[model samples]
Target: MRSALLTSGTVALLFVLNALFTGSLVSGFAMPPYILQVLCLAGINIILAVSLNLINGFTGQFSIGHAGFMAIGAYASAYVTVAWGDRFRAATSFLPEFARDGVLLLFALAVGALLAAIAGFFVGVPSLRLRGDYLAIVTLGFGEIIRVFILNIDVVGGARGYSGIPKLANFFWIYLFAAITVVVVSRTVKSSFGRTLIAIREDEIAAEAMGVDTTRSKVISFVLSSAMAGIGGGLFGHYLMYLHTNSFTFIKSIEIIIMIVIGGLGSITGSVLGAILFIALTEGLREFSQYRMVLFSLLLIVIMIVRPQGILGHLEFRHFFGRRRRLAAPTPPVIP
Candidate 1:
């Protein structure tokens, strides 16, 4: 109950912050539009990184087709909003305009997440049996296949890209979902099911021998990860009011992987920190746009060489603070 209350309070506080940032509550205190865009993108990246961590970091899966699920979500949600948005809004016409739009966005996000989860299940069932590079190859292929498939679907503008999506996503919605993603992934990591995933990551064969349903656990993780990614993609689509297969390519998946790896593979705190840093660095280097990739690559190389295990090296924020508290505590009197 306390945890639930705390979560609610945190969400409420975030809502107020979002209002301030968007100038909904205080026009004088509004953040700049460019800054708000960067923060919104950061929130989406946080959702993607944290969700992918559940599969790759916790479940020891090497699936790299995260972008495929993201694409599915983006296009699926955009299709709904473009095709039936008016109907949805009409059904909820009694509500204020903002509230009606929010409801429509929520419904679209749900559809995207559901479709992505379904795709994840289908892909995970067969590909998850393979380990390491083989799984990665399958997932990579899946992502490519999804892109190609979407390219041929004229209903969604084919290769031309899907446009005309409503701009319903705002700071409040994006950060709210990001916070929920963090809470869900963190709680899962602390649960018994999460222990099973960690055990599988440590030793799959041993975990299987110990009677853990490794396959089921992995598939479930994949579905949950995909659903979260879908939510992120939904927000991305609505925020940009566009959808393109090019955005959800193999490179996109790699960026998410880099976020988790840079933070610490097995740590949720690391994922959040990594996503923020990655986005900040990317945005900060916009002035050198032509040489940005080269500079980014060099910086990543240096970071890897300096701390290959990641910024946090599998340790969480709580662990770090707890260690500090322990060190600061007064020493007990020794009886001589």
Candidate 2:
């Protein structure tokens, strides 16, 4: 009951904070739209990093094709919204315009996630048998294939890109889903299944010897990660109101992996922190766009040399900021 109440209160707080960032409120406060948009983008990146961490960090899978799933989700969701958006709005006649669009946004998001999961299954099932660099190579190829395929498909504007997608994703949806991603991934990492996944990560042979289905767990992790990335992609496409095949290329996948690595692999909180800091850095250096890549490469080298484990390493931020409770002393048993 306490936990339930706490969860509800947390959610309420998130929504309240979200309302403060709405266009009207921001305009009232004279806050810039770019800041709001960046915040939303950061939230989306957090979702991507956290989801990818589930597979790479906790599950010990080296998947370089995350952007492929993102592309699938983006294109799929964009197509659905463009083709069937009016139908969805009309079907939700009882709802307010904003509420109706929100509902349909969620539906479209789900559609994107489903399509990504299907793609994950096909990629994961066959390639999961491979390990290490082989898996990485296969995933890289997969991402490239997806990008090339999308470039040729004129239906989605092909190489020209898909445009005019509904701007349904805003700070509210982005942050809400980002929070959900963290919570879900956190809970999942603490569950029995998570332990199994971690065991596989620690040592696949040992885990298999212990009767854990390494391949199965890997596939499950891959699929779950892909689904979340897809959802993030849907959010990204809708927010930008455009989709380009190039946007979901190998470089984007590298960016996500960098976020997870610099945040601290195998740590959910680290991934979130990493995404936040990484985006902030990227934005801060936006003025030096020409040298941005060089600057980050140097920074990464510094971090790798000075602090190999990243900002958090294997520890949670809670360890630093959270209030610590004292353990109660055990009462002495009375024999008499």
Question: Which candidate leads the pack in lDDT?
Answer: 1
Candidate 2: C-alpha lDDT? 0.89
Stretches of candidate 1 above 4 Å error? 322-336
- Residue-level lDDT of model 1, residues 1-336, one tens digit each, is 998999889879988988899888976788999999999999999999999999999898988999999999999999999999988888999999888988999999999999999999999999999999999999999989988999899999998899888899988899899989998999998899999999999999999999999999999999999999999999999999988889999999999998998998999999999999999999998998899779878877987999987898788888867545445668889999
TM-scores, in order shown? Answer: 0.93, 0.93
Q: Return the TM-score for candidate 2, rounded to 2 decimals.
A: 0.93
Model 2 residue 65 distance off true place after TM-score fit, in angstroms: 1.1
lDDT of 2 by residue, 160-234 (tens): 789979999887788888988998888888898899999988998999999998888889889999999999999
